[model samples]
Target chain A: MRNLIDILDLTTSEIDELVAVANDIIESPQKYAHKCAGKKLATLFFEPSTRTRLSFEAAMYELGGNVLGFSEAQSSSSAKGESVADTVKVVGYYADIIAMRHPKEGAPLVASMNAGIPVINAGDGGHNHPTQTLTDLLTINREKGRFDNLTVGFCGDLKFGRTVHSLIGALSRYKNVKFVLISPKELTLPEYIIKEVIEKNNIEFVETTNLEEVMGQLDILYMTRVQRERFFNEQDYIRLKDSYILTPEKLENAKEDMCILHPLPRVNEIAVAVDNDKRAKYFEQAKNGKYIRMALILKLLEVE
Target chain B: MTISPIENGIVLDHITAGKGMELYKALGLAELDCLVAVINNAYSIKMPGGRKDIIKIDAEIELNLDIIGYFDPGITVNVIKNGVNTKLPKIDPPKEIKNLIKCKNPRCITSVEQELPHIFKLTDSENKVYRCIYCESKAK
Candidate 1:
């Protein structure tokens, strides 16, 4: 009956529980391997994805469940003019749960409404990715050991970064969390998000074009890609692409304990040399994505 | 000149002037074969500049109050039965609306999946803001 359409769909307590379970899974991987012995997971990705789709597959496989469905829309019945509701209804018969990623923002929501089984939104356009938010939460928990009283700096593509928006939504639920939004004016966080989540929640936040000025104050630095696909003109994309590249020189000003995070497949936004830094937790964050997804699948399936 | 009072139908009163046609279209009034009266720029004692819109449907038809509230929450509804004003239902806008206002975001899934219904949820009641449930685009 439950679906992971948005990060807010899960309560703070539920998120904490997911993190707790994820931590346990990390510590004792074998103990919970075959929890969903006979369950099936359908990954209905309408768009091509490497990490998000694979993470879901790996999570389900580790849970002793089988995976089905398509990696692209062309491969699915969608190419034959099948509606999302119809596709979901048909898929619900074959799978115990569904993880769908679509180019359209609310396609998963449409599926969730019609699906008989629990639906997990792997990624829905740039609208929401709750599982990624959970993964980010787990990364923060593991790296920093706490959530409250932390200054999180969101750099680059704050406007179009769904992960940034999602993480900000999640982090705002905690106490004493301040946001340092670093981006060009064109890519600044959307006004509705500002009015709805930040200002409405009374969370302290500062907006600036300079990432270096606010680098030292941050406990968590969340980086996002300024997508080339989002731009109509190549000149604008090229001009603003290198605006906030996090290099060793920039990292020098940040706190030693400051955790660097990114929803990966990052382009030149992050310097290759900075990957060696202990603070860069994106790879580990990617790995943690599987565990949290495992925790999510198990929780949704109600498999003990 | 005063318009004749309705006897056995729903009276939608106090709609903002120049918005009655929109409400009529939204409510699919064009499909209605029954007698329907729309008084545009009607005199209003309470409103500033004494202007409002009044719709008198001369039949007892099922109306979705939530949709009415969303279209124009300031409007008042009066249910008339057998030449009598029977009840005035509370017109609070719904928190969640399914298959209604579409998400305006170009990147929204509904845009591609043309068969999908446009869904919205009332995110900010004070601001009277309804956002696309899919992409969270604020309704215009």
Candidate 2:
């Protein structure tokens, strides 16, 4: 069975296929509505989530599939110290697929290893959130129309933004994609990603703390929240919380078509006024998440 | 000082100088009941520094060659039976290792799930980079 623990788990062709399926679902929602009518999706969330859990439920519901599982660890058997493997193994019997989210990294992978059913990693700590990457990919594709030859600027906390890392890893596979990393030095992109994903791929990239300096050059401005949960110390979190804020003034120099994207629950990183901007696509991104997830479910379940 | 040759055992030769104790500790040779001799800074014509370390085991015990290969593939292994030496093929770094090293990342699933085996996959063989399969954290 196919499981998506990381964005790299899907090849470029597979990703294209998913995007195509997602677009088709968007075009004619009723055509694929009954595709997974008899299937059940088990959303085993061991951590708190708002959009992701709801998106998975909405996706499954739209596909005519039944949704069953907990929204948090306390609501599930995990609160009683049940292992991810055991929980998924038991759930596999009842559900045809699983969507898991956990605070600990690789919990879904552990689930996938034991789960007889296909598993999708909804989110896992700050390590990976491949579905979010897919959402961003769909947003970019719909807004910009192509993944190649775009100057993508990743602003704010690149260090703890699993979405940014996953998106960068995904985009590096494309041709002529230049990355403009804008973040404070303390919250810069991890060295391993720069060395392994960007440098190894020979992708052009420039790192800077100033967002405005490179704002005009970007075709896609991917803003990320400086997550307070990812910090070990309150002082560090407070110090970096307001590092980058996307506002109307910041968009002055940006291209008219520069698509702004964010994985929601954004905190104060994105200004409320920017939401009115035509270039703002974060809401659309969230909507796209449901459709892509529907496509992913259909693909994993091998439904016609 | 001359050490008595083992009648039937294994000889680990050409270990990088100063890594004999590390290899011994890694292999848990200190816990072994059989006689084990570690010769440090032994003159070697093949080694770059003209010095190497050699380990002689007095009993036929199973050795994890992957650990040895991860340490240094240049190190040679020899099986001695009835005072005759039989050199084995050169060791290669293992594609995957389990329970050898713990994932140091605090957020890694293995850290909380004590029952989960600490597994690492060789992601970059050229750099000998082994990363935890769970969190992709580099094995230090």
Candidate 1 lDDT, A166-266, residue by residue in tens: 99999999899999999977789999789889998999999998888999999999998777777778888888777788989988789999999998998
DockQ values for all predictions?
Answer: 0.79, 0.92
Q: What C-alpha lDDT values do all the predictions have?
A: 0.89, 0.92
In model 2, the clashing pairs are none
The best candidate in terms of lDDT: 2
Which residue pairs overlap in candidate 1's backbone?
A104-B109, A105-B109
**How close to the true structure is residue A201 of candidate 1, measured as C-alpha lDDT?**
90
Off by over 4 Å in 2: A227-243, B30-33, B45-51
lDDT of 2 by residue, A1-304 (tens): 7999999999999999999999999999999888899889999888889999999999999999899998889999878898888989999999999999999999989999999999999999989999999999998998888999899999988888889999999999999999999987778899989999999999999999888889899999999876667677899877766658888998899999999999888778999999999999999999999999999999999886
Which portions of model 1 miss their true places by more than 4 Å?
A: A228-240, B32-34, B80-90, B98-100
TM, every model = 0.93, 0.95
Tell me, by DockQ, which candidate is best: 2
> How far is A241's C-alpha from truth in model 1 (Å)?
3.6
Encode model 1's per-residue lDDT on B38-130: one tens digit a residue: 889998997767999888898889887778888877788889987888657667888988766766788887777776668788888898888
